[model samples]
Target: MAKTFAIVVGESSGDQLGAPLIKELKKRYPDAKFIGIGGEKMIAEGFESLFDMERLSVMGLFEVLSRLPELLKIRKTLKNHFLQNPPDVYIGIDAPDFNLPLARMLKAHGIKTMHYVCPSVWAWREKRVEKIKKSVDSMLCLLPFEVEFCQKHQLNATFVGHTLADKIPLEKQTLQAREKLKLNVDAPVLCMMPGSRQSEIKRMAPLFIQSVNKIAQSIENLFVLIPVSSEKREKQLQEYLVEASFKYQIIKQDSISALSAANVALITSGTAALEAMLCKTPMVVSYKANALTYKIISKMLTIDYVSLPNIIANREIIKELLQDDATEQNIVNAVLILMGKNEQLRQIELFTQMHRSLIAQADIQAVNAIDSLLLSK
Candidate 1:
């Protein structure tokens, strides 16, 4: 008989992380079955999903509140399904809003529950720690700082290192990427990552395009590159660009290539910022949430900076313009400073040093930790 495991991954980043994790989990139990909410990548990894995971990829408190009844229905369906055909373990990959409640419900039904990514407890609403302590049998955290925080709260947490450390190539690996893209070797390139979500594109794209206009007016021989994560997102991004009449190359399926080939990036905060650091590209990070949600959470957040690079470094190494501050002029100014000789050198040094601190054998370490947890139970 083979061990059965059911995993729920929500959204693209979670799906990406879950696919590799499922491969690792399968190495331990070859016939393990993955089920629940997930995107295309998880489906490709033999995971049977309940619905299109993209539908649950919402952010901001207000955005989620409006869809509360629907979210509850999905959770109820998942909870009942797991109870009917319980697995040895249930792993919820990110999407804390959706995943946490499901984990709690399953754990109540005597199912072993785990959350792969720790919510930003250190950042805000530390009260969530109480719920996390009750819901999860264990939490697998990507950041080193989170381990200490988890331990202090008596939560079972492991520092699995960052998955990007295993995925991103450390060597000087850009010229080939540039050559493949056919980008000008002499010109300075800037990658504009407005965001992956449709609402985010609507919020940030116009400002991002306007900043491009500013840069184009001021700087000569500068090129802008945009990497779209999905075909739907690419089409939406193109619409935004066309509406604004901004000319730029939209690179599909080669995000790493675009990141490596760029001098600096004007980006929305998330995994992409970390990817930029791995690719040796400095960035000006920006983000905006729905008005009511932003207003409420902005007051509660304890952290000073928004970008992961800045958060891990314990200082603002790169510029961050968030919400109303995330204007075209501010973005253009930050990128201009990044383009300077001295500032550019400093940013590279910061990324190189940060990379040195984060690179551990993350995948193997994570799998071993998960195995240990299973054995302990």
Candidate 2:
């Protein structure tokens, strides 16, 4: 008989990590029975899910609070089910809010628990380490900087190379990507990534639309491209665009085109910005959050910069306009600057440097790292 593992992943990002991790775990224990709460990718990888992942994808303290009763019901059900018949291991992927407490309950019931992707405890509340110690048997981190903190608390942690380091293809040729997407070779392209979440789309879409209008007022023959995740999200975004009265072309599912087809991008600060950087495009980063959440989180953030390019570079290479700073005027100014002499060259130069730094290993490396960690204990 083979050992069984129950894995719960929180959102799209967690889903991304879970898929590759599943493949690696399968290699380690060929006959392992894997089941969990995850999105489409895990299901495709032969994992049985307890529920659709969107249930756990809720964001912000207030948002989670509003869904408290229903969430508690789900958690209680999971606790009872796992307690009755525990798996050999329980792996929680990146939905710390949902995963942490569940891990605690299951761990207390004698199931071995592991958390993949440390929450930004190093960036914001160092106190979270104590909570993490009680919940997980081990912590798996993607960044090199995070291990010390995990070790300080005496929790087992491993620095697995980032999934992006493996997933982002090296051959994203600017002209080739543009030609393949049927974008004009001569026109300056602008990629707009509003966000992946409903809260983000609701909060940032209006400002993003207004910024687009401001940029369009000055530039002629500008090609604006937006990549939406799904048909439902695409419809919701189109409604927002229509309501805001911003005119733009929508790309069905080609996010790579949004990166490679662009002269520059005005993106929300997250994975999309990193992807754009990997594609070697110049960009300005922006973000906004709920007023109360922003006020609380602002004081907690220790990093001087919010954008990934700036964080990775340890300095501001690409411009970042956050919250009140992310106005139409500033966004337009940043875009205009990128369009000016040698600005694109400078941005691409920095982007290429960052890409080289991230090229240490790919997905297989991350898989190997996880397998090694599991075997170490």
Candidate 3:
């Protein structure tokens, strides 16, 4: 008999993480029935999504409230589907708010549950660990430090390494990527990645746009590449660029190419920072949230750092300007400081080691962890 596995991911990032895991699980169970909510990548891998993945992509605490009724309806539907036809195991990849609650409901009914990523409870609310403990049978962690936290809390978790680090080559392909992007081999190139979401573009895009002019005033022949995730985001940024004059291109969603070809990157603090680190690009990271959200998160945050590269290294390898400090001048100054100081070489040297440390063939290990869960059940 073929096995059935249900997987749920909250956003595009989780989709990226899910694709390879699905591929490997197929290798492990050739006739397995895979079902859940996913996006393009997972669909391409032959996974059936019961609902559109974008419905659960909203971020921030207050932002989720407006969509609560629709969300609850979807959540109830998922719970009912899994309860009626329980899979051998259900894997929730991030979106702890949605996934954990669903996992709790399913786990209570004798269904095995697994959570792919460890939530940032160590950094934010330590109380969340209890929710996770009751919700998941095991956690597959991407970062090394997260395993220690899971162990301290006595949860079944594995350090499966990061898929991005495994996917990105340790050797920098700067010249090849530059040639493909039609960028100057020696000219200073800046990749401005404000964010994938419109709310983030509204907040960070203007600062990045202003910084380009200021950065060009100091460095000769400066070129900027803004890799917008969607056409709507491109149109939104076009409005911002209507008043400014700069050497730039609104490239559509080849962030890896943008990061690889650039001499330096100005990015938001999150997974993008880790992507930059894996690509061996030096970056100045920044983040901003609404006043109320920032106020609440700022007080609850237990750690000093925001970017994953810095958090993993346990030191400030890259500069982070967040909240009230994310200004145009600070962006320009940080960019200039990085370029003027020749920071890429130092950052790349450390990034190579970090990449080596994280490339553990994650997809295979994650599947192994899942197989282990099956045996225990």
Candidate 4:
């Protein structure tokens, strides 16, 4: 009989992680059947999606609460489906809020469960490590530090390296990327990534737009590039950009190209920071959540930095302007500092070193870890 695998991924970032794993898993078991929740990438890899991945793409505490009923219903449906007709193994890719509880329930019924990305327990919610131990059979981690943390808690974990590192080249081509985007090579280009999610864009887009207007006054012939995740988000950003007085371009769903071509980036903190790092773009990372959500997260967070570049480097390699501090003036000032050649070169050198540290064959490593769990069962 062919092996059956069920995988659930939450958002675009999760979709990117799942697609490569699905392809590699298919190579191992050509007759394997994959089913669960995913986006375009996993669907292209021949994985059957049970529900639309957008349902679980919500972020922040307040955002999740607003969508709780629908999210719970989707989770309940997946839980019941897997319980009735269990796959050989089930993989939950990120979205710990929705996936962890579902994984725990499936594990209770003797179903093999794996969580692709470990939650930021190391950053906050230290108590979650205990719950993760109960839920996950194996935790496939992207960062090297995560392995020791998971092992110390007695959860079966493996460091699979980061897919971004494997995919991004050691040397990024700025001029070529600019040429591809039809941008002037000499002009100062700013990549403004509000974020991938609607909630994030809603909160950060106006802030970023205002900041761009401020920066444009100082830097002449500035070209701003904003990468929207979808047509919906592009429209949303366009609505916000109506008040701006600056030269800007909106690129649909091509964040990498935007990041690669930019001189500096004013990015909302998250996966975009990591992408900017890989592209060797000097960036001022900023984020703002709903008032209540920021308050709750502020108390819970154990770490000093939010951006991936600073978090991975374990220091303040890049400036982070968060919540009230993420004002238009602060953003403009940070971008001005980043415009200097010495500052840009320093950040690029650090980015190169960070990229080298993360380059492991992630797909193969993830497959090996998943296969080990299946064999043990």
The residue-by-residue lDDT of candidate 3 on 278-301, one tens digit each, is 899999998888888889998999
| Poorest stretch of ten by lDDT in candidate 3 | 225-234
How does residue 359 of candidate 3 score in lDDT?
93
lDDT (Cα, tens digit) per residue for candidate 4, span 1-377: 89999999888889889999999999999999999999888999998999988778899887898999999999999999999989999899999988999999999999999999889899999999999888989999988999999998998999988887898788877998899999998999999988888888888888888888988999999999988766777887888899889998988767889999999999888888989999999999999888998898889989999998999999999999998899989988999999999999999999999999888899999999988999995
Q: How high a TM-score does candidate 3 get?
A: 0.95
Measured against the true structure, the TM-scores of the candidates, in listed sequence, are: 0.95, 0.90, 0.95, 0.97
Q: Which numbered prediction scores highest in TM-score against the true structure?
A: 4
Tens digit of per-residue lDDT, candidate 1, span 1-377: 77667787766778777878877778878887778887777788788898878677777777788778887888888888899999888888888888898889888988888888789989999999999988999999988889999999999888877777677776535677789899888788888998877778888898898888888777787788899867888988877787543457899856788988888888999878888887778788988888788889889989998788899988999898988888878888889888887887788788887787777767677778767767875
At residue 62, what lDDT does model 3 achieve?
A: 78
Lowest-sum lDDT 10-residue window in model 1: 239-248
Model 2 CA lDDT for position 198:
70
Number of backbone clashes in candidate 2:
0
Alpha carbon lDDT of each predicted model:
0.82, 0.79, 0.88, 0.90
